[model samples]
Target: MEMVYANRMTMQTIKSSTQDQNPPTSPGDQHSDSGVVKDTMAKRSTLSETVNQLQTNYSSLKAERDELLTNYSSLKAERDELLTNYSSLKAERDELLRQLGSKVEICEDLFALQIFISMFHNFWIGLTDSNEEGTWKWVNGTTLTT
Candidate 1:
């Protein structure tokens, strides 16, 4: 008797589980279920598209950043080169100025020499008397003894 009772209880449980699995469905319920599935799929596809777009934008930005870095490096190299050239030119200019100063000093000395020569020439001319060879007289009216 216990075995029979247990079998009957088992059979009743199986029947209830089957009924729960296949709950009575209406035609309208089937349409609503399909609609929910379609909406969920649409949302998933939209989210996937957004993610793809973001990934593409990220790649493009990364490439641009790399390009900018390369350009910056090139410009830095050029700037260093320019600085080196500027230093060299500055040294050359300083040397040239030193040479020019020396030349100016030489020119001033030459001008002084020319002025002295002119003064000496004028003094010799004034000290000479054209009267006789032995009558050489100074401009102050002093006669030469020799």
Candidate 2:
């Protein structure tokens, strides 16, 4: 009889241990789990939207960067063309200056060098003699008196 009672006590202790390991969930625990699931879902949705917005912003910035690079390339080409033109103009101006050393000026014989130099605009005198030969005029609409 004592052995049978000991066996019954052991079985009850084993059942209690099993119940402790796998506890039954109450209504409050179920509600809490549902709330956690809802919270996790909300967080996931927010994160997805944030990622999409970031991707859109990245695309916009990339487009802007591409446009700026294109503009830079165009400006660089224009600058190169301008530099080439400047070099050509400088060479022509120097050649004209050398030729002027041999050519007699209309007013240089009568006026002082300073007086003739004062009439020059930026030290450049453009004669409009190409259109009509023997009829010369300054670019600023001053007719040659000689």
Candidate 3:
């Protein structure tokens, strides 16, 4: 009888130890899992918000770039027009200068011809502004301004 009682006590202790080691899942564990899920959802929401903001900024920048491109094209057209006008004016001026040179050569009076040539030379010098170097200036007297 004594050995049997000892065996029964040992079995009861083993059962209690196993029950303590493997407890049943409780509502608390469920709440902990829910907290983790909430954290993951929040992180995803933040990432999605950042992505949306970046998309908006990209669209805004694209619009600005398009506007700048349009303005650049307009300015380029204007510059081309100005260059054409300048070329036309230069051609007309050259023709006028050639005609004036031929007329000056045909003058009969030597004194009058000399006076006319001197006046023409003075006018040419004044137009070119040889004394002032026009608008071009150099930092070290090398004159690189164009």
Candidate 4:
């Protein structure tokens, strides 16, 4: 094992043993398991930009849905219109909604993936002290046998 990792494990052992005598000071640090580091402001700005883009897309999609609804109602009112026209228009509207549904699902999946990756990276931050830092342990309370 690397000296750094070994030292960190030793500190963790000492800290855990002494927890009853002294309470931990802080919850944990913000460093993540990911090798990449991000500045707080840059992360915030990226999130803000993503949110703004999503809002714009939502508004656009909403307007399109509303327009389809208006057309459907107006077509329904025209009782003389051929059944084929109504059916075709309804199909188009359904297709639009289905496409939008898939897009939303994709976005949701991507967001969940991002959150999972972040959580996975940071999960070990709390179990060890700073002196023996950069060591990763399984997040579950059980100690590893190996």
Q: Model 1 over residues 1-146: C-alpha lDDT tens digits?
A: 35544588899987877745544486645554777887899999999999999999999999999999999999999999999999999788778979865221122355776776765543233357677776889556778555
**lDDT comparison, 3 vs 4, better candidate:** 3
Clashes of each: 0, 0, 0, 1
Model 4 — TM-score against the truth? 0.30
What RMSD does each model have against the real structure?
Answer: 23.8, 11.6, 12.1, 39.4
Q: TM-scores of all models? A: 0.49, 0.51, 0.52, 0.30
Off by over 4 Å in 2: 1-31, 102-146
> Candidate 1 — worst ten consecutive residues by lDDT sum?
101-110
lDDT of each: 0.73, 0.77, 0.70, 0.63
Cα lDDT tens digits for candidate 2, 1-146: 35544588899887877746435477545454777887899999999999999999999999999999999999999999999999999788878978876333554454665687876535444578876898898766778886
Ranking by lDDT: 2, 1, 3, 4
lDDT of 3 by residue, 1-146 (tens): 45544588899887877745434477645454676887899999999999999999999999999999999999999999999999999788778978876331344466876887876754321123344756444323454333
lDDT comparing candidate 2 with the true structure? 0.77
Segments of candidate 1 deviating more than 4 angstroms: 1-32, 102-146
lDDT (Cα, tens digit) per residue for candidate 4, span 1-146 = 65544588898898777746444444443334222444666788999999999999999999999999999999887865667788889788779979865221122355776776665543322244333465544344434233
Candidate 2 residue pairs in backbone clash: none
- The candidate, 1 or 3, that scores higher on lDDT is 1
